[model samples]
Target: MRAMEPDRHSYISGVLVMEKTKLLYQQMYSGKVFTWIHLMPIFCSSMVRAQIQTNSDSKNLVTHKPTPTSEALSGVTVEPTRKSRSDSERPESLSKDLFTMSNLSVSDPELEKPANGSYSDVYEKYVLPCIAEFLGTAFFIFNGCASVTENTEGTGHLQPALAHGLALGIAVAIFARVSGGHMNPAVSLGAALIGGLNIFLLIPYWAAQLCGGMVGAALAKAITSDVKFFNATGAAFKSIERDEQVGSAIVAEVVMTAYLVMTVCMGTINKKSTTTLAPLCIGLSVTVGILAGGSVSGGCMNPARALGSALVANYWDYHWVYWVGPITGSLIVGLLLRVFIGDQKIRVLMT
Candidate 1:
């Protein structure tokens, strides 16, 4: 039996090696699944406050009434009144991805039912809307780009795609009521073309969004790991070197942006109960775009985001592809929706 000792030792070593390999793969899979979830705390501050409160009209936020143990003799009964959607506000706008019916509803309000009613009054009345856009865009850029900063190969678009999709959904859920959650300049322009937004407000939304993107990108650079590698790579969008063509890149961007903008417009058309889940749909559209276009044009539907990263890294490789492709696609889709989709004539405040 002494001669067999070496064989036993070899078998034990092989088993140990197999276990270690399995552990490594498990860790990698977990990282991909939870990457987007972990980024939530990094950029979710302020955007989620008061947005999730179920009772919009309730002055009090406290829900505590009595503990089960403390009220053994006489239990305290607490019944909270729930607020339901009213009829005064029904037909929602096309620019928004989610559904809201209250006067406080920040998604797309009608052209006549501006938060302040008239461009002149918007500055004082709904200035918070601009700030909402700023913060929303910033959060998107910071979290979304964080993944791209690490995914230099572009094949790892899976992580970046998931990050961007989930980030946009959360941002929209929190800020859609205030600013219509137009994180992309392309989205704002399309909404403007469709008469869903004030024609004059488009530029302002663009500026705020762009500024947010720049600040978010800069802040992301400061906080993320491997700054040297990220900076060296410039974190700019590039076509997959092997099979990328200028025409194909343009088409990919145009198609993906079209899908995104179209989903936003159609998702809120008072069609289904799922309208309230517009944020998820819009986010999914972004994910789908990345899946379809990441290899071709970096799947950049937002020019502001592209511009922000380009400025930070001083990298402009095929930068125009982002702007031109998304813009063209958004314009065409907006006009198509206007001509064929029919007027919505939405109400302002919920009853």
Candidate 2:
């Protein structure tokens, strides 16, 4: 259930069978399960009719009617009908559990997607996910900013970089399924570019992420006593050396943001990715971004990160670099992914 896990599969299996059965009875699947269940007897009767009709011309047919018995059942090929193929042939979509295995269809034509198809589903589908994005981003930036605020010892800058990486990995592991764990606005925008998310929800995601980041940064300031150091470090991203001009900083942001967004597209956004280690891959991307460009452009691959720190610390220096660079890079990768690796093309897309 979690990206970082202690192997709770057995426990979750038990809960799945029990809780989903309850949901099935309570109409969680909108009574399609009920209809399917009631139809099974009729289906079995038809199958029996077909079987008996096929066997009637056999030379070894029983001559008289008889009561039901174990021997009679033994002769009947009364298979509990499977869908399309044997259970073993079913895809790992069954990993979602039996209730959610509503169909083996290759396309959405098998059933209408939304039973209600009303505005009410907006709350369940979009609002809750945005809430999760908010809370998860809050958790992410709070810890990450804390790391930055605490890194005032003049030691190497690796600690804050690793801290942000590890913190992001943990948050991603927790919130991946909930809201794609996109603590960064650039990542959410990238998701929108392709069709993983509804276009309407993108602004809400950005708002939640930016707000969560601001809250986290403000809270981090409250926790630390060294206001000067905290303000200085937590303000915003800046260039230090080589190509310190605005153009080079923008390039750094674009390259680093592209790397991060591209990995997310391949590892998590792409349906075909078999790697279960989304947290590890995405986190390492952040770490590498920091190590590679932290000294040059401060590795602010996420605009929300820079924006939040700037807002909290009241620092507005070079804030545009973070936003322009990341948005440009994410859009570039998003377009590339859409053309070459999107879900529409079978040769490139995952199922």
Candidate 3:
């Protein structure tokens, strides 16, 4: 019974050992298969990460590199970005350019050209006539007032007439280069009709002459006030006889002014005569007319000149006759010249 018990225990122990070995073999086989499956995916993931890193490094190199000379040879131009400028910088540059241009214009030697026909050609053509009329009228008023001032003890009709003639002559001569020397409204109107001057200029010239005459009269009054010879109200040397000889004054102004306008037209616009001496001739004509009729009419051939004197002298009695006579005479002479002399010769010569 003891021997049989020993054998049985040995057999049980052997069976238990065999079972443990089989279980260990199964666990080892399953672990090996699982490891094989996981290994491929881990290797693929590592390869992909390395490839991504290499691509990133290549991109960085491209961005950091300077432009190649080969690209330039192929006609590629790489321009740098410009920095933005501020608004405050633009006006300063513009101002500098303007100042430079102004300096050049003012300093140029060509500014003193006379009839050489440079610099303000348009001003010479369109604006000079009116300017002359204004200036001449002013001159006439100043000299006329001086002539008839009550304080000038030696002044008389002949003296005043000579003064008027001299003033008219000088003014015309000075402005002849710039304008044609049309100083009176009647003369301007007549010239426009006879010489084909622009009729549009008449109104402006008349206005300017009138206004300038008024200014000149005011200046003359201011100057005469300082002199002891002037009697403002009484008929000593400064006073004009306002109440005496109304009809005689009217007739004298009409006749004298008419003659003056006619003489101006004949001297200046007549194709048969030379106008180079027109200033002197016209002035002499006015002097003769004044000498003939100055005692009766005050010898005022120009309405503007007469009006200015009258206004300053506070005398408006014979104003209408002066206007009527000069205008009538101008119109009549203009018609006669147009009919007799004609503008054909002048136009042909000019052309």
The TM-score measured for candidate 2 stands at: 0.64
**Better TM-score candidate (1, 2):** 2
Which run of 10 residues does model 1 get worst, by summed lDDT? Answer: 90-99
Give the distance in Å from residue 304's predicted Cα in candidate 2 to where it truly belongs.
0.9
| Per-residue lDDT of candidate 1, residues 1-351 (tens digit) | 855644454455334433433343346345433232332332232123223332232334355454456445566555555553343332121112122223222332254464546675766435777888999999998988787776656467798899899999999889877778879988888877766567777888888999999998888788667665365354567664544488898898898998888877666542432288889999999988988788778899999889888888778777888899999999988877666653544322231
User: Model 2 misses residue 92 by how many Å?
Assistant: 29
lDDT value, candidate 2, whole model: 0.72
Q: Each candidate's TM vs. the true structure? A: 0.60, 0.64, 0.58
Which residue pairs clash within candidate 2? Answer: none
Query: Per-residue lDDT of 1-351 in model 2, one digit per residue for the tens?
Result: 442232243334334434434444445344343444533333343344434443442323335446677866789643232123333432232323343444422223334455575665777788878888888777777777777777767765687688889988998888888888889999998888876678888999999998888887888788877765455566456454344477888898999999999888788877777368888889999989988888778888988888888887777777888899999999998888876766664224443
The runs of at least 3 residues in candidate 3 whose Cα sits more than 4 Å from the true structure, single-residue gaps closed, are: 1-121, 226-250, 341-351
- Estimate the overall C-alpha local distance difference test score of candidate 3: 0.62
| lDDT of all predictions | 0.70, 0.72, 0.62
